[model samples]
Target: MTNIDIEIPHPIAAALTILVALCAIVTVDHFTDFQASAGGRAPEEIVRDAEGEGLRLRQQQAVLQKREEILRYQLEMLREERRLRGPGISAAIEADIDRSEQMLLDLIRDQQEAEGKIMLTLKQIWDAQGRAISISRKAGKGVISLTWPVEPTLGISAGFNDVHYEELFGMPHKAIDIPVDQGSEVRAAADGVVEDVSDNGYGFNSITIRHNGFATLNGHVESFLVEEGDTVRQGQPIALSGGRPGTRGAGHITTGPHDHFELIVDGERVDPMLYLPPVPN
Candidate 1:
């Protein structure tokens, strides 16, 4: 019979071979880990872990945001309390105070109005009494009559050509102008009681006398003959010759020496020719 040879590996070498296989497998895993973030795990599992971490971080941020909101609310409440405690109150509260103050002011105004009315009543009574006393005088009872107020030489010439005569009455020209010289002689046309002897400035004097409602005016005269309270006769020499001759009155010596004579009936001036006898030119 022929004998056959069989080879068997040693135990130590078999263990070394197994160790080498383990080392080779570890080297492959390290190489893969160096190149990629995950080592052979499912894509879903890796994504799920990432999402969980993000969720945790978001929750922490949410907690911080809640803390900030609470602090803001607390600060706002403290300010509100301080404002309400001092003069920093709301506008609505101030408006109510203003309304109460205005009500008191209105009461004061009402009391002042009542006092003013009472004083006005008393003043009216005093004025009426003084006016009544003045009405009882005898001086105002006299009548007024105009005089042929120029020198005898000017008698005809004084009342001559008085055409625009009616322009002497009513409204603003309530008084007619009897232009005479600053020093021309003036005579009474009729009997009259003198009321006022007034200086109408410009060296031209005026005589206002009364004959009932007939008011006679001798204006622009230089001097006066009859006093304020004198009674003049029909042909009496009442005023001296003239005025600032050739001025506004223009009662000069020659033709410019004219008398502006007016006769006022019922507080209104009328043409003097209506009363004077026709001149014997």
Candidate 2:
């Protein structure tokens, strides 16, 4: 090896260096492209997949949010019930409380299934209530007379077809809500036979009394004092007022202790105030 010195032009040397750098870059880019293609998805497909995943996550979040809301409401009911459970409770009442708690837990586990069952139960109860009213209309042939179901001392909390109720529950309130103390006496609005007593498991326990050409429903009752088919006189005690959250008869939604009263005339729900005496000042 004989050593010979050859000096190249600076401009040509610079051009060669740039060319080599360009080739390296091209090789690296090709390798990266091949690696990406090995996954059997194009760049656009990868981007689309990411977008789809994000959408799915968002939908799942929405479902979870709704579930959380339902759980919160149920939990509030549970807490109220627990608070109402005092010491020295009777065994029968304790067992009922346990069942109620279990029902709430089951609802939390399977909301959709529980909701379906509740809807079905309500439908059946509603049909029975309607039948009771129909029977009353057919059985009697006298003029309608009415009395107050509860003392007018508390006045009315919510009225017939209450707009606020419709806004809150998305349905018109066909009855009236009379604010009364918990465990207050609920009296019969008129002389009638007790046709039905039922509970809808959501805090609505009611008694329907059939009178001449009309019917009366007293909801949010703690307990029935009279049994079905028993004749009751006007101003007679029929039930204890409820509507206290977490109590025996107070359903899921209630503002406070009160009575939900309905008066049906001609098979239609009308304003109870129209038929009842004016509230005492």
Candidate 3:
């Protein structure tokens, strides 16, 4: 039996061993880098990063809370200002009052109109009983209701159908005449749109307002505060009353300074007193 000795190269063996060790070291470093990204960092580093992120989030929350507080303070201030101004003084409150008052006036007008119808029915019943119903022409003319157009200080110089005056008509005057001081304000009887503003060269400055189904005429006006096609609310000033005996716009048929007020229903002239608020005592 012959014994054979195998010779291995030292440099090749050493290089092979070094390569294996280098591969093991590279694999360990790669795993460590992966662990750091996956939240497996060193304990001290993890705590430091967590504290920083928490502080940042808390700061953001504080900022948001501060903004909320500022908004709340501003809202409170606005409320306080409104409270200090007193009731019915704010714009919204004033608007509400105006709306409510207008609605109430309108309701009253409707109720009065209904009452007029009821009175007419009562009159018919009386007539059926062989009793003559003496309906006051001035008080109940079966007409729609309206707000007063003039101030209380004024008085009716001539009534709707006074046969005493020739200028007022031979039998029945179509309108009423209320004496007013110079430059007295004349308001609308109800909500309406101005249909016409005309002047008769003889002396009648008239402003006609068209309502729901009726209309009102403000005649013998000195000057008009509203124009044709203008919308007016009930009791809204439409003209300055001026129809004196010698005024520029005084009606030729009018005896003195007065507002020749007329109410027309469905195109037919009616007595104004029946619709207007009662004459001030």
Quote the positional error of residue 71 for candidate 2 in Å: 9.2
Per-residue lDDT over 1-281 for candidate 2, one digit per residue giving the tens place of the 0 to 100 score: 99998766697888899999999999989868875775857767677757856754564444344553443454565455556666766676556556656665776788776455434433443555566557656545667678888887868878999986544443347789998767899999998889888865554688988888888888878888999889999999999988654566765545457888888776677788988888999
RMSD of model 1, in Å? 50.9
Comparing 1 and 3 on TM-score, the stronger one: 3
Q: Model 2 clash pairs?
A: 202-251, 203-250, 203-251
By lDDT, the best candidate is 2
| TM-scores, one per candidate | 0.37, 0.58, 0.46
Off by over 4 Å in 1: 1-147, 152-182, 201-203, 246-255
lDDT of each: 0.47, 0.71, 0.59
For candidate 3, lDDT tens digit of each residue in 1-281?
Answer: 99998666697888899999999999889878867786787757677768856754564444333332322332343344345557757576445335433433443456554334323322332222111111111122333659878865657766766665422222235678777655789999888778677654324567777776677777778788998879999989998887543344553234445677777765456787776767668
CA lDDT for candidate 2: 0.71
lDDT at 113 for candidate 1? 44
Q: Per-residue lDDT tens digits of candidate 1, residues 175-234?
A: 223443335667877776776665433333456666543566665555677887788878
lDDT score of model 1? Answer: 0.47
